[model samples]
Target: MKIQILTHTYTLTIEVETQETILEIKRKVEYYLGVPISSQTLSVCDWELLDGLDLDDYPIVTEGTKIDLTINNHIPAIEIRRQIHITVKFSSRKHNIEVDKTETVGSLKEKIHIIDGTPIKQMTLWFLGVEMDEDFRKLSDYGVDEYSEIIVFLKTTSRMVAEPPSRKLRFVVQTSSALLDSTCIPLEMKDSSTVYELRELLLVRKLLPIDDYIFIHKQRIMRENCSLRWHGVENDDYLYIFKGTVSRG
Candidate 1:
């Protein structure tokens, strides 16, 4: 099957086999783009790919899946955190780590991704048997504290329940005056689609240039990992687009 490699400035199509390792694909990228394999990081839905793993290890990666490519430009990517200890249990294994209570669940997932090669999209965190469904909410908001035991479940087809039927949502993408000359693009998509997917669709269709973007709905910033329905977006709703990322406070 073919997959797309998305860089900050361009997208490349690469045919891949299910049995192929991520490191092998990185070598191909190195040959095609002249970027060293050591400098490239491939991810799908913010899940970092492990060099030792093959495509089959990641069920989310499929035909036409878009993988994000991030280049290490010798910049320090680590951030200082006010630490609190926590235990993340996944199946039969457990990992103890330090995290900031002020960070969001999404950030926590990223930290888990760094520790283990699990994809952020595949993880479902729980505390006190209640699922942490809101990625934008802080750990403290979920009542997570020092030495909290966070349960982790991997999302798989077998573990999934019957999904709700997808509904078509027609809406307008209103760009800022500095972007697209204040153009309003009409779009139709499924309610199940995420804001990040919508942004990828725009970039793939050349409706928007390759760059980081933020979407806002009804004055509230949209979460990339969340669906339109989760944001209370409806048909004919106007989604405002801006040319930057959100600053998590």
Candidate 2:
């Protein structure tokens, strides 16, 4: 079958056998692309391909199938790297590190792990109040310059306790726009809270202008009357507040 592999900045097409495993296909692509298989994430039609799975198993894996490849980490293209100082804030304590601008956020997190013994998976990094969830993105993407500060928040698992009758869902609300500064706000509401109710709260609280702004999660605009539970919004989930239109008289 003919398959296409797409990366952040490149696209490659290759022919593969139906009997070949996904790992084998990845190796072939890696040979041509020079990107390590370990860093590559393959998805076909938004469904992730497992290394152990055979290509023929999925009915969608036919000729001319387009597979999306995402690199989990960034690889520097330049040989000579310049170091810059950066500060990471974890609760009350702040840790500083010297990093190269070309290095990936994952690499920075690894350095932080060495310093504080915190596992990279449990730590979340934020720049300018926006969560740096995409480890593949370089520090420069967030406009990190010399002496830039990144907020570090550690995720903790709750100890087992008596189950409550009903649990409220807590999610993060943040603003994003070229015209406004980024801001993160924590919100707690019942599982049955609808988007309309949240909008009303934002209107009353004056956190965001209701008529001018809209809520977005995972790039999808939230609709009124849809419950938070319907969107699968869980604890610490981020919702972006974006300006819907420019106010022009």
lDDT for model 1, on a 0 to 1 scale? Answer: 0.78
Task: Show where candidate 1 strays beyond 4 Å.
Answer: 1-161
**Residue-level lDDT tens digits of model 1 in 1-249:** 777788754466665679989998896565444467888899998899999999999999998898998988673222212357899999989999867676678667767876887877788899998999887788999999989999999899666543346699999999866567899999999987889899999999999989777687764556787677656678999988765443432
lDDT of 2 by residue, 1-249 (tens): 566677654456665678989998877555444567787789987899999998878889887777898776475522112458889888879888767676577657766876778776687889998888776678888889889999988776652223223359888887653324677888999966788899889879987754554566654445565567545567889987644321111
lDDT of each: 0.78, 0.70
Candidate 1 lDDT at 148 equals 95
The number of clashing residue pairs in model 1 is 0
155 Cα displacement, candidate 1 (Å): 17
